[model samples]
Target: MNKGLLFSCLLVAVTSVQAAPISIPYQGFFQRLKQVNKGNYPLVEIAFSVPNKSKCLIKSGTITTETESFPLTITQDQRIFLPYDARLKSDRALVNLDIKGSADNCNISMQVRAKNTKQSYSQKELLELQAEMNTMLSDMQGFPMRYFSQDIEGINFEFESGSQTSVKIDGQRQVFTDKLRLSQEQLNKLSVVEFDTKPLVISPWTHG
Candidate 1:
């Protein structure tokens, strides 16, 4: 099948789950895997979020390829990290999700992430990440829609417990323990960001 067609099929399958199992195509999975590999990330996660108002629960799941089957472990937060397997790059596979109730009641997404809780990043890398994140946010809230939408306020770096890190904002060294927030303007003005211990995760921070 054409790659585009396969992707379209996968989208349709994910969006219209009804009472049946969700089937993700090999092509889609491979594309995400390739992204992780290219970035040198340890794992890619498939996350399912069930709305608080919804009663649906995921019962079980498995990933099956042409040559192997692996049982999936769904976390308490309803996320499953795809196991890294070099063989998956060359094989056809499908991820099957079984829901106890209605699959349509849940939201599914995929994210690439680093494995380590602490890792160093250069100033150049931080700037690059800021630019990429800003571009993504702009694209998401572009043109007419941005006028009414409440976009994220800034980027936040979440550190592991008891970890301390520091970054220079406008020539002043600011230290943080649990979390650090950097505005887009601050990120642009940043010259040196020093970390005693690297952050565990970097995410968008939205105002409440």
Candidate 2:
């Protein structure tokens, strides 16, 4: 979604939580541990939130797999999410987003996997949607963020509340512990819930 559209949606669904200065290299979405090694997992999807009142040029970008890395095509002022797939081993991968005219470079390491579910719902189902996620999270304790890095998902529902939680499930049936840290205003304008659990690795700009 475009920044204007997303901001409009946020305004329509205004909450008590106020906005704060969040850094870039934001991981809007990524793979969850339990589903990473699954047969259908996606390679990667990259997204970011630019600083308010400021924009940066995407000087260069690249995705590095186990033993190889390739350049990515990104345009100036392109802020929406993009999908990336090297089709190499996805057990571990690295992404680098070098912003022009800025010192901060966004780097991320994550597991890529196909999504387990993707669905849409009406605005009336917002409460139900959250409730369902809470239930699933309760069963698994909570989902985990990337190790040695920031949250793989940029949107922190509990940043202000500071009651963040994370959990991971392994294929070997092992449970691992990890830690880390949305909105409505414009609900009326929203036509669908747009739920996607598939962790797609987005390429900056591609025609396919």
Candidate 3:
């Protein structure tokens, strides 16, 4: 969904909460503890959390999970609530975003695993993209700058936010934690919620 569309959706979600009567569940300590590994930073991984009482039906295909589950909606008011809390952590599903940061700063690159039908961005393409990225971030940080040095003889660069799946745009890799900091308008424009939970390692992925 584009930024505009997402903003609209959020508006609608908020409206729904306000119009209806909702209640938060009183789950025990174990219940609350179950939501710990939501693939995001900060133990509670809810981006925009909406909890509920007893239970509710989740439409088919709304998520990729094989089974259906419900924890609760945390709001009783009319405002749309993204899961910023942990009470319903176990009940929520995730949309991961991966990111990496350079010590020098001035660039934001995302790691896109596949493009069209190809498996990884090529080395030659990366250089060109790197040049373009420098241009994009230059204006953001003020004054011109260069990459932090490709001294990757063994410089394992790894930093991740939510699930660790990053998007490779213009040869850069960015995580959800980074993206979340974007303006709500910017986030609404994003659509590729990468399911990247690989922990942003320098090497390949392995199941946690």
Candidate 4:
């Protein structure tokens, strides 16, 4: 069992469920990137854990980078929200971040216009995405056979002619094809994803 646990994405999905509203789990650390559109739809990518079976809802969270800042909010109903145009105007957009605290901590950085085009997931769909990514990553890089580690290394993607490497920030193997202007529909059968040249990565813990 290489993936005994799935931290971030699964937490978001489970929390969204009416029966499974998320509660902060530990005083540890976690990281995730979330996307929310004006429609209130959310897409999540995480490298950490939520308060497993605890009693806190992610009303909102944010991350700051050298050039930008990205904040995420989850409504009581668990709708993820990110205001991008608002972030672009800010001094620092999140380049990378990590969460560490006695409270629930999850790091997230918004990319590709947090609102440009968000894809929401049904419970089944969200689980499918996580399963798909995990399976693929195991094939490409060979994940650990016994357990999953909180710190996922070498999960970034580099474009052929691009100078920057876009870390898939989320530990899963799937990529964002539509965001890359690639053919998402045409590759319906393939599990591979492409990253935008403008990229982000997973860092360590931030006390906040």
Best by TM-score: 1
- Residue-level lDDT of model 1, residues 25-106, one tens digit each, is 6555555444434542222222223332244566777888877888888765565556666566557677777776666665
The lowest-lDDT stretch of 10 consecutive residues in candidate 4 is: 109-118
lDDT of 4 by residue, 24-62 (tens): 321112222212121222332323323321343453455
Give one digit per residue, the lDDT tens place, for model 2 in 1-208: 2221211122111122222211222122233223322332132221333332143445566655557666655434333333433243243454455554433322222211112323334555533443333232232222332112111222112111223233221111222222111243333345443422221221111011
Ranking by lDDT: 1, 4, 2, 3
The list of candidate 2 runs beyond 4 A from truth reads 1-56, 70-92, 105-124, 132-208
In order, candidate lDDTs are: 0.53, 0.30, 0.26, 0.31
What TM-score does candidate 1 get on C-alpha atoms? 0.50
Candidate no. 2 TM-score: 0.31
Please report the candidate that would top lDDT against the real structure.
Answer: 1
Across residues 1-208, which tens digit of lDDT does each residue of candidate 3 receive?
2111211122112212221222223232223223323222221121232222113212111211225433333233111223334534455443221112221221111221111122243434333333332222222121122223221111112343343445543344675452222222332344322223422222111111
Estimated TM-score per prediction? 0.50, 0.31, 0.18, 0.25
Q: Per model, state how many residue pairs clash.
A: 0, 25, 36, 16
Model 1: lowest-lDDT 10 consecutive positions: 2-11
